[model samples]
Target: MAGITGIGSGIDIDSIVKASVAAERAPKDAQLARLTTKTTTQITSLGSFKSALSEFQTAADGLNDASLFGTRKASSSDATRLTASAEKTALTGTYRVEVEQLASASKIASGSLTGDSNLAFASGGKLTIGLGADSFDVDVAAGATLKEVRDAINTQLNEKGISANIISDPANGTSQLVLSSNKTGAGNDLTLAASGADLQGLVTNRPAALSEAQNAKFKIDGLSLESATNAVSGAIEGVTFTLVKAEEGVSTTLTVGENTTAVKDSLKKFVDAYNKLITTTNSLTSFTKVGESGEPLTGALLGDSTVRNVLNGLRSELSNTAAGQGGDPFRALADLGITTQKDGKLAIDDTKLTAALEDNFDAVGSFITGDNGLMNRLSDRVDGYVKSGGVLEQRISGLQKTDADIKEQKADLETRVAAIQARLYSQYNAMDSLIGQLTRTSDSLGSALSNLPGVVRERS
Candidate 1:
C-alpha cells in the first residue's frame, strides 16, 4: 500500500525533517482532542444551570419572572397589598348600589330679557345680556361702545364655558352679539339684566318662552350604581359620582399576570446546549474509520481519565439533591435516558430524557439551576478553563512554547544536516566528473597512437 509519498527524488534532509514534524503534531492533536472535550462538557453544564433558574421563577418562589423580561407592572399610588392566593383570586365579588331617578323639580325655572334695539339708543342705562359660553353680560346701553360689549362676551365665554360673538350686518353696522351654551341641555339657561335702571326693557321678555328638564343617573364602584343625580355623601370610599344614565358604567375588575417567557426561553436554551454538548462528545467516539487509510482515533484525550472524571463529576453533581432536599436532580442517567454500559461508556436514551423533562419540571429545574445547580458548576469550570490562565489557555500556551522550542532545535539540526548532504553530493559529482575526463583523455591517446603507426611501433 502507498502509505505516503514524497515529492523529493530520493531520501534527503528535507524529507527527514518533514517526518519529524508529522510525529510531533501527532501528540499535539491528542492534546487538542482533550481540550475540545472539556470545552464541550463545561458548556453543557452551564446550560443546565440556566434551566434551573427558569424553574425557580415559575413556582411561587415569588421572584416574578416578568421583571426579568422588562414588563414589571408599575405600582399604583393607591395600591394595597392583599393577601391573595391563587385559589382566592379566581372568586368574583357580588356588588350592590342604589340611586334616585326623579330628583328634578316638576317646573322649569324661567327668565327673560329685551335689548336696546327694542327701545332707543343714547339711553344711559345698559341691558346686561348674559351668554352661555361664559357669564358674559353684554352692556346694551344707548351709545355704549361696541368694544365694551365684545370684552364682556369674551370674558363670559372664558369663565362660563359659553360662546358669544357679534353677528353684525355689514351694510347697516347693527351687530347682535349672540350667546350659546358650551354643553348640551337646558341647564345652561339664559339670563338678562340692567344696571343703571330704566334699561329694564332687557328683562321684558318673560318666562313664558322656555321649558327644561333635569337629568340624573347613578353608579357604584365604577358600575352603574343607578340613576341618582343627588345623594347624601359618603357611600363608597371618597368617590360619589353623579350618574347621568343607569346604562353606562366602567369595568370594575382587572386581571394581573406575569410573563414567564424569558425564564422559559432561558431554560429551553440551556437544555438545547446541554444536548448539543452530549452529541458532540459522543461524536468523538462514534466516528468510524472505514476508509482505505484506516487511521485510528489518536487524539491526546482519547483515553484520558481527566475527560472521564469530568463527565462523572457532572453526572454526580446533577444526581445530587439541593441541601435539605429529598430528591436528587435526576434519579439516574436512565431517568434522562442516559446510561453507562459494561465498558463504562455513556449511552443516551432519548425517551427517558423526554420523560424526565415532562414530569416534574421544577425538580428538573432545581436539579439543573439551583445554588447547588449543575449549570453554575459547569459554567464555573468552563469559565476557568477559557480564562487567560485557565486549563485550555495553559495547554495552548504550553503547546506554543513547545512548538517554538522544537522549531529552534529543528532549525539548528537542519543547518548541520544540510551541510553534510551538500558536501556528500559535491564529492560524488566531482568523482564522476574526474572519471569522465580521464576516460576521454585515454580515448584521445589511443586514437593518436593508431594514426601514427610507425611512432606507435617504436613505443610498442
Candidate 2:
C-alpha cells in the first residue's frame, strides 16, 4: 500500500517507512550476496583444476604401455621392387631378399560364336563358376542374349572373385565370353561348367587359359620360399613383404631395427604435457600483490588441500626408484635424462636421453613403463583425483550443495524483507490518519471558544 506523504502531520511518512525497511534488510542481503559470490568462485576454480588433472592423466597413460618401446621399423633397399613392414614381435636383423616371380591370376575364354555380342543363345541352363574353394551358380534363361548371360554372372559371382564379360570381334562378326579370377595364387584357377547344350559351348570347347594362375617365388637370405599370394608373410618372423615386381637376379636388403625415434617423440610429448599441467596448477594456486597499500589478490585454488595433495603425490612418485633392480644403470627417470627443475617441473636432456635409448633400450622401457614404474604410479595417483567419486569430484559435489542451500536462503530473505515493508507501510499510514483527526478536533474547540465572547483567535 502507498503511504500518505506529508499530509496532516507535515512529515514524509513514505520516506520514513522506506528507511525503516531498508535498515531491516541491509545486513541479510549483504550476507547472502557474499555467500553467493564465494560459492560460485569456488565451483569455477575446482572445475578448472579437475580439467588440468585429467589432461595430465592422459599424458601419463600414453607412456604407460610397454609395446611403445618394442616398436620396430622395417625398410627395404629397393622400395620400388619390394617393401616390408614389421610388428613389435620382429627381431632386429638384416636379411637379403630376392623376388623371383610375381603371382598371377587365371583367365579363360570361350570359342568364338558366329554372331554379334547381342546374339541370343538357342537355350540356357545352370552355369556354375568356381574359384579356389568358392563357387556360385547362375541360371541362364532360354533365348537369353550374350550380354544378359554376362550381366547375370557378374551380379551373382562378382564377390566370389569371378567376373564375366563379352569380347566382341566386329571384324569377323564373332564374340567370345571371357571369365577372369581376381585371386592371384596357385590352385585358384577360374573354372566354368554348364548343364545345357547352349551353355556347354562356353565350357566344353573353350581355349586354353589366357593367363595361368601361379604362386609367388621369392628368397630370404638364400632360403627359397613360395607363397600363394604376392604378399608373403611368415617367411621371416614378424615381417610382411609386399612383392611389387619380379627381380630374379637383383638382390635387396631388408633391415629390421628398433624404432627409437618414436620412443623419443613420445617421451618429448610426455615432458611437454607434464610442463603444461604444472603451469596450470601454478596459475590456479598463485597469489599476488595488486599495488602499494592495496589488498593482495589470491587465486581461486589458493590454499586448497586437494591441489597440494595431488602435487605432492605425483612428485613423490617421480622421485621413487623402480622395483627389482640388481645394479641396473637405467633404473629411474633420472637415469634416462629426465630430471626435476627448481620450479618443480620436468626437464629433458636430449643428448643423455638419446644415449640411454641407444645403449639399453629395453632397460629404458622397464624403468618408465614396467611394473611399479613411475608412469604407472603417477597415473594411479591422478586417477584418485579425476575418476568418478574421487576426491575432486566429492569436493565439487559438496560445494554445489552449499551453493544450492545459499540460494534457498536468499529466496527466504526476499520473502521476509517484503513482509517487513508491507507492515511498515500499513503502520505509518494509520499514524498519519490519527494525526489528521487530532488536528481537526483542536481547530473545532478553538473556534467555539473564540465565538463565546471571552476567547479571541491569535495570528502569528
Candidate 3:
C-alpha cells in the first residue's frame, strides 16, 4: 500500500484510495455528528431545567413551615432600659415592664499593704475563695510574693467566674489586692478565708466592698419578678427580658404580636422563585427566527414531553385549593392574593395580600403549608422529577448513553474506512504491477522477433 503505486499504470492510487475512503465514511460520520450535537444539547438543557426546578423547590420548602406563621415579634418602648424578645409560643399581648434594678457582680479590695507588689508575704498558707456554690483553694508557697499569690489565684480560679489582681497605689506607696466575682446575684457573693497570718491579713482587714452582688428586680404588669441575671426568661411564656438599667419610677411597654412581615416576605420569595422557573422553562422550550435569512433557531428542549409534564404538574398544584380548610377564609394561594398570569408566571397583589394576612394569618399558613397544602403538594411533585434516579436523571442518562454509542459508531466507521482505503490501495497497486509486466513482456517479444530475421517492423 506504501509503494510507488501509480508508476506502471500512470494512475494516482493514493488519491483514488482517499476518495473511496471518504465516500465510505461520509454517511456514518454525518449521522454521528448530528447525533452527538443533539444528544449533548439535550443533556445540557435537562441540566438547566433541573437546576431551575431545584431552586423553585427550595423556595417552596422554605415557606412550607408551620412555625413561620406562629413567629412572634417583641418590642420595647424604652429599649435603652429594657429589651424584650419572644418566641413562637409567646402569647400576643401588651405588658408594662419596669426595670427597678439590674443585677451586679461583687468586687472586694484588701486593705492596702505598704510595700511593692512583688514584696513577699509574711508566710505562705492555704487561701480559699468561694463563688456561687463552687469553691477553690490556692496553696501559696512559703516565700510567695503578692504578685505570685494573685497569679496562683487567677490560674486556679479564673474559669470559676472569679479573678484576682493587685491594684497598685504608687502615689501612696501601697498596693491593694482586689478580688472580683463575675457571677452576679446575692447568693453568688464571693467569700474568702485564709489559714496563715499573711493570708488572714488579706481576708480580715478587707475594706468595704466596692459593689455587692445583687439580683435584678423588675415588674411586668405590676407583677413582681426577680432574676439572678439581667437576662430574665421564663417569667413570661416564650419571652426574654434583658434588663439594661433601672427605671424605678417609669415603665416601658412591651409589645408581642404576630410576625406578619416574615410571612409576607416568605410568600414573596416563593412567588419570585416560581416566576423565575417559568421564565427558565419558557426560554428552554422557545423557538424563534433571527436575521434577514430568517433561519429558524430551536431550543434544546423544544417539543420535549418531560418538560411539558413537569410544567403541567406544577401548574396543577398551584391551581388547586387545599382541602380541610372548611370554615377558613383562605384555602388557596389565590385567596392570599397570589395568582397565576397568562404567561404561566405568578403575580402578587400587595394590598390584597396585606389585607389577607392581617385578616386571616393562620388560615393563610394552613392554605400554603398545612396538610395537603399547595406548597407541600408542589414540593412533592417536584421531588418526583428531580430526586435521585428520577425522570430527568434517567432521561439525561439515556441521552448520554446514546452519545456514547454514537462515539463508538464513529470509531468503528473510522476503522472500517481505514481498511477500505488500504484494500483500495492494494488493488490499485496490483493492477499497476500487472500492466507494467504486460508492457515489459510485449517489448521483449517484439525485440526477439526483430532479431530472429523474420519479423517485419513498420512505422505508423
Which run of 10 residues does model 2 get worst, by summed lDDT?
1-10
Ten contiguous residues minimizing lDDT sum, candidate 1: 75-84
**What local distance difference test score does each model get?**
0.43, 0.85, 0.86
Return the TM-score for each candidate structure.
Answer: 0.40, 0.83, 0.87
Q: Which candidate, 1 or 3, would have the higher TM-score against the true structure?
A: 3
The TM-score obtained by model 2 is 0.83
Candidate 2 regions exceeding 4 Å error are 1-16, 70-73, 76-80, 111-119, 128-137, 166-176, 193-195, 200-208, 248-252, 259-262, 321-326, 341-343, 439-460
Residue-by-residue lDDT tens digits, candidate 1, 362-408 = 45555455445455555543444344576545555565565566556
Per residue, candidate 2 scores C-alpha lDDT tens digits across 266-374 of 8888888788778878988899998887888888889989889988888877777645388677656788899999998899999999999888988778777855777
1-460 in candidate 3: lDDT tens per residue?
Answer: 5767789888888888888888888888888889889999889989999999998999999999999998998899888998988999999899999989899999888777878778787678998887767788889988899999999988888888889999888798888788998888878877777888877767766888888999999998999988999998999899998999896879999998888889988888898888888888888899898987887898888898988988898888777765645787876678778898889899999999999887887888878886577788889989989999999999989998998898888888878887887788888899999998999899999888887866567767
Query: What CA RMSD would you report for each candidate?
Result: 14.9, 3.7, 3.3
How many times do residue backbones clash in model 3?
A: 0
What lDDT does candidate 1 reach at residue 383?
49
